[model samples]
Target: MESRPKVTPLTRPSARRSHVPPLGVHPTPDGGIDVAVAASHADGVELCLVDVVEPHRDAHDPARYAERRFPLDGPVYGVWHGHVPHVRPGQRYGFRVHGAWDPEAGQRHNPAKLLVDPYARGLVGDLTYGPETLGAVSAPRRPDEPDSPDGRWWVAERYGAPDDRDSLAHVPHSVVVASHPGPPPLSRPRVPWADTVVYEAHVKGLTATHPDVPPELRGTYAGVAHPAMIEHLTSLGVTTLELLPIHAFADEPRLVAHGLTNYWGYQTLGFFAPHAAYATRSARGAGPAAVLDEVRGMVHLLHEAGIEVLLDVVYNHTCEGGDDALHVSWRGLDNAGYYLHDGASPAALADVTGTGNSLDFRRPRVVQLALDSLRYWAEVVGVDGFRFDLAVTLGRTQHGFSPDHPFLVALQTDPVLNNLKLVAEPWDVGPGGWQTGNFPPPTAEWNDRFRDAVRGFWLDAPREGSHGRPMHGLRELTTRLAGSADLFGHSDPPLVRGPVASVNYVTAHDGFTLADLVAYDHKHNEANGEDNRDGSDHNLSWNHGVEGHAPRGAEGGDTATEPWSAVVPLRRRSQRNLLAMLLLSAGTPMLTAGDELGRSQGGNNNAYAQDNEISWIDWDLEDAARDLLDTTRFLLALRREHPALRADSFFLGTPRPGEDEPDLLWFDADGAPMDREAWDMAGRRVVQMLRPGPDDGDAHVLLALNGGLDDVGITLPPAAGGGSWERVWSSSWDRPEAPDDEADDVTLESLSVEVFLNR
Candidate 1:
């Protein structure tokens, strides 16, 4: 990367203290049409009015348009006044500034760059990309050439391009002008954390290729709220649809080069604005209100289904990168104040996001901006909650990451956000990045441990010579299944308790889909165009037989045929076992999109840049996939039916009222108590868990799992309160079978799980 230009307070012009002009169509103090552009660094600013129908060669055609130059007494801080006869909404204009371009000392302010309005609510044309767009300077003569003396001049050319004639003709110039229309009136569903089951999904990928969704509505907000989509989510018993970021984001320059996009939508350009691409109606002709209405409609429909809407928000940084960055909103408004700069140097940015810059949460105004944006989404968009991406960056102050940082404190105390479900990714690529369990009370975090543990148990442990020991034994797995109290038990009030505090998952957007987890061991990222150098190395995954592509039914190999074929039967069983473990756990269980239907990324663990079929959910599934979905549905229903499994209090290894047995009990293959030796034995595979009855006092559950290669005999402990054991559901069994009401013991198949009720 090229070294960023240094910006010093003393060397730069007094324009550093300029203010941002207000946005939107509003009457002036005199009740006349008022238009202004906020250009803080301009010595002399001119608003050029170009004829929409004229060609570039006809610049001298006075018959079509005109230009007005406004000399500034100082840098135009807020608004540069242009009265009725000159400017108004729908007027197309561009800015020309007069400043310095001294590259040696880091002051590159070419008046010819033609800056976009920082407060522009809409964009009329696509940014042209090519060497000619780099201004008057020539392209680097050679590939490895460094920034030449005229590099700044070359950079200026790429700054501005003529708007697309057709795209611009249809788009009104005034549409780009910001308007401070007060918050939209929105009806919100107030659901508590205990009753909420969040379903995390991608806005575009979720319905983009769904056959049931209309072609026009595919990958848009309308698709998300389509009757079919709503009905499906409602049928799944989802209480909250936690959408990945829908904010306007820029495709990374590299990913774009490879014909891929930032499908995950993590790179945000505007916090308060929605991504125009996700809108069914064009933002250009229909305007921001149209987009807002569609988004609100989606929220309304979800609310009508009694499901809440939550947004995964990225506030760690702005899309405008380093010194070579665009003068977009925050970077233009106040780069030094809005972004975290090296405290010692005070000129270079401290990039914690690895996206070129990190927002400075220490700055009060920046903190206010984040808080204001959160409020805007929650109030204006009618969102029920927010999942902060790389949230550790938001809570960091000058001293380091603080639990009581002003931004966090403000969120915790703010009346509007107080009751909202606040979740955090919890860490960033900064010093002390692994702060998984360090968040303050009431903030649920993505439990990476749970993901690893479950993956280890069902996939990694089954494959021999996989380096790590198999997690087939009960103790460690049981702790994760019970919410990992060891990691979250330190809070004074114990905020991260029960089902509301932990977002348990086996897969997420950043990793392989559940199917791929059981199909591949190493990341195959050659498609990322980095010579397979990109993506993480620590997959902790295993392919049962063959490695990547293998012949069908090839004996002794881990290929999809032999060992991989065996995986087919084991995959569904393991999936159900994992799903049962997640739903029955004491934390909030999050289901990754398409995990229910067995979506596979073709063993490509990292599909960040694969936006094609490899990343899109097939939706079409085989019989096994259907079976997995049905099993998940049944497990979800079981969780809904039992409050004891989802209790608000942490299990203390003690019995409940009217039950002589502890709330949870561990048993070995022979139905005997699991002693220390048995718990430590690496050969142990059969384990059983018993949960006490709920408030009804008539329900109790016995969950048994046999990971061995053959059937294992299990003796049932004496029934609590003189009741007999009855099997309610089993992964190995096709239908729900009543347990042997008279028997004290039963045998379970290899790699199977069974859930029983006491009568």
Candidate 2:
């Protein structure tokens, strides 16, 4: 059991005193490679060397390589280590751990299953969800059961006897890469939390259909760094580009069977390896190292443009899925130590992430794995921050989620991770999972409250007795505009996490685009092959006068030839209103990609599986699309210039040093300050918010909104120093080309937003 020898092996006097190698395949100074793995319950571990038969063969070809197994030496502190002579870069490998197959004790080790190293820096090929990849056999189908069209007969009996069929041909191989996997490290943009305007985008969907991007680079990492994309982001005032998962992932078997794919990239396979599919054709052909360089190059270019890069990392669960899923990695390597269990004889996995399995953060090794991965991305790959998907699950313990959990504490105290931006999705499917404001300081959260409040104020139609008003009143709207102080403002330790802790967003990747939000009252997810019952029904949306204005090749099956409805103007106004609130509020704002272009999925709220035209951003903009883009750019630029809009701290309603006017003042339509009666009125549709600029020399800003269907004359409140109000922008106009108007009494159009500055 040895590798094809070129150099002689080095030996120590005693194996007990020999030093253990670090985990994963690391090339040593000597002409050999050191391999280490933690297989606590395994009887033996064998390192398999793979020789590629054809370099450019199909990624999933079963006979793509020939493998030779060599036994490794260890069990020291439950870790296995070995050195193979003459191993060099680009060598493909995997591991086989031999141990007891007693699922009752949660030891699911199967030598028959070849496992990818969890710490592999480079991985090639994709996983096939065939019988070879499963740890256990499918249960016997009853006479009444229906046949599986995909040959996935029935649910797997995970506790039954192990399936001895070899899985070497079904899964990917871990490649031994050079120590420096990516390009030379570049300085990170390191954008401040308060000043960051995050633009959430999918690497492929962002520029897949862009007319300006070259055909060779489209739908790849190189496409993201294209000058056209860079110019768009920079001109739009985006300070950060938050990418969806770039980690290697696998499409769920169900999605494969349905003839669809997981376009969201949430199902992670290898955390260390970049998804090769995202690289250009030349890079993929060049091998795994080239793919890494392409990813690094994108980050480098984005950083050069003064934009930060944040990764949406999914560490809550692996792509291996649940009890009835594949055994490609952790499940086969160390099932008991890696995953949470329900305390049964044959322990059932405790799944908090909807993806089927939840990793146990209680284990030190598991926490180490997460911490190591974070450091690698931050230091090696040069990313600015991370947004944890299903973050609540990472902080969960036996008693439930705790802010003081070891993993969370470690992140806050770690030297390499503490300074980076840490954002939490802040919820899971588990009990007490909605811990929105419970995370510790410095950890920002996605504010669903902001999304709902803004959407309700602008999109929901008037209810009975509400006098043509939207569902929410002045109080709700004002609260969100002021940064939802009740949620983020804490008194236990005054301003522990200020208004900046809230990431305000009206629409995100999971739901409808901003355009669809104003045009569809219900979700059209029938394209997902789950009937119409797959997505959320409580959309809190209003279709206005028409059911939909389907874009070209929309997934909802609507025709593009349908005439525009009369309510089109109103829908555009509502989009402007939502965007204004999101950008002008006293919190960090996150804009979804393509919202600026008024992109639509034809009312398909859940387009996660629609990887084609429905999900890819259509860059061929019409007149209306161009107008919306201009509006977004104008709003973003205004927010950047005005410090009052993106206030770092919450307003206290009291006067600041040497200022007579309060830091923030509320006014009624009559130019008088709002009283208790006005604040509590449900029929009130118009409200004014006045905020002082950063300094006395700067102009004070006032935001006025009319949520009613008719015109409302708003009497301008005198500035602290007494000056006329200059109307700089209005949502009534289709674009921001309207001239600035100076007036004391400004009439606001129906469902419109207007901003004023006192000169």
Candidate 3:
């Protein structure tokens, strides 16, 4: 192995008097700013002051602003000097630190590189990506290559030229505040955990081109809080709006090179600051409080409408990236201490997040930062809960991912966050990753099994013939519908059963939309600038007949205007099937944005890089799409009508009254008991399931699935006591009401699911 570069600790002389700029004012004691940067790092640091009086001050404004250099002393981090004059909110500022530049040893620092404050409350300007921002540094030369790396630094560069590519600088500390002032009083409707329905959406993509939302409000925080958006969410009967990451994030340098930006704000730079771009008004003109006030107002408005707010947080890694990355707060403060460094070298980071470095939860300060951020958002920001991104990373100690990790324990025991809904992404790109059921009882995780199994039984399995026949046994589907006890056992209480422990979903922001899943057999990500090598290969998708937007060559290239052929019916049926399975399942269900109205990614499975039409949800839906929306509303009503489907506890896999068999049973096409040999058969494509009656002994439900290519006869099981089975709902059928008694034994069509009730 090659030897690593030399490492050295840089130190600066202490000053007798404080020269740091004054910290901004705090409206409330709890909302005051903490100078964490001063206390954390011991390098040459200085705070740049931008004048608030000069409204249109530029970066080169010498008279209006000044830079004060400061040095750290033992114990006393720095002085605040209270709220100084001419230094209110909406001030643009940054930090200049003179540090070492040794990428081989994992420390790349240049005083010339203007850096953003890691804890800035708000941002002022947009980042300009290119080579001029790269700073006066050179890559180390390889022994085999004779060229000196020094010539690259002094080369003159043009704005759009290839050599000027490194000039693109990321505005790391540009934080955006709510446009209005003060946190809105908590007035949202309170729905119990068992009855909660979560609707996950992206603020920008959800209404970027929405027709109903006002043009000014579209694609902004104000737009999402508009009456149109609220009415839509309310109509769907969603109790909580689980938003994707909204914190101020940095657009990757490479994405900018490809003329794209980070659609999902996962690369966080400011934990306390909201992304200003999502605000309808400009942060510079409206003031920092404008952004802050608008966000709080949105939360309050949603609350008033009986909805909860759950923010998706990303704390696994900072936007600063790798060793050669920028020296933002965490890296400058104490790189080795704040990040997970190699055990052997101590100064080298152990890149676990695949985004460069993973935060060191083992450190007391690092753990405190995370806990404090969470509490700040929940209490100060007035959010209902948090969905942690790569949560397993925060739970890892020296041993492994532990439920007793300090961060987990703190959240479970924290007074402020304990009552709030706590959710976890459950896994990171690290060793011992993919911890689905391993989260503490207090936190609910996104159930990947639910996503895969449901997709497998309905679409993936039948097309590929992977999991012993394309369609699974009714016994297996019943277990999933009633909550998977096999995955989450009885180790926890009924209130914390596997069902409540999981957040069920068929599609999410990371993969294909519900529509695209039923329209594309393979991923089409050639537009991602990676030659289709960027997205996941195991999509588990199936194209009904065509691949991209056009029909396949095998179908004689028919371009008819059929409902299913045009992506409308397929989207509706797939969404209805997925939603019915999700809401009717025992776990809490989450609905993706626009899935209720048949949104499509144009058959693009992975759209992480496509910030344009490929990722944005088309708010304008056709009549068929409107019908799909109605179907979603109807399904939500059905879910709300029955408590059995959303039980906090898992139902025992045993026989029940009002049903001929157990709470769950596997049956063949003839409605006969399925044997082990039959269950293992790879060609089996049909199964029937029976859900036990509610605890109060109300009605029983029988679900049937057929993944075969042709219609098949399905014999009805003998009804319990003296009742007869009635067809209540079918994916192939249009109406909500069941068919007449004349169809006792129904013929199920290919790629169809039906629900029957015993009356």
Query: What is the lDDT of every predicted structure here?
Result: 0.65, 0.83, 0.67
Candidate 1 local lDDT, residue 480? 82
Using TM-score as the measure, name the better of candidate 1 and candidate 3. Answer: 3
Please write out the lDDT profile of model 1 over residues 13-46, one tens digit for every residue.
3444444333322345554344454434334444
Candidate 2's displacement at residue 586, Å, is: 1.0
Q: Rank candidates, lDDT, best first.
A: 2, 3, 1
Query: What lDDT score is found at residue 560 in candidate 1?
Result: 46
**For residues 280-334, what per-residue lDDT tens digits would candidate 3 score against the true structure?**
7663258656776678778888888899999999989887666544444556445
Q: Which rank order by TM-score, best down to worst?
A: 2, 3, 1
TM-score, candidate 1, is 0.82
Query: Which portions of model 2 show Cα errors greater than 4 Å?
Result: 1-19, 53-64, 139-155, 181-185, 461-470, 550-565, 657-659
What is the clash count for each candidate, in the order shown?
15, 0, 29
Candidate 2, poorest ten consecutive residues by summed lDDT: 5-14
Whose lDDT is higher: candidate 2's or candidate 3's?
2
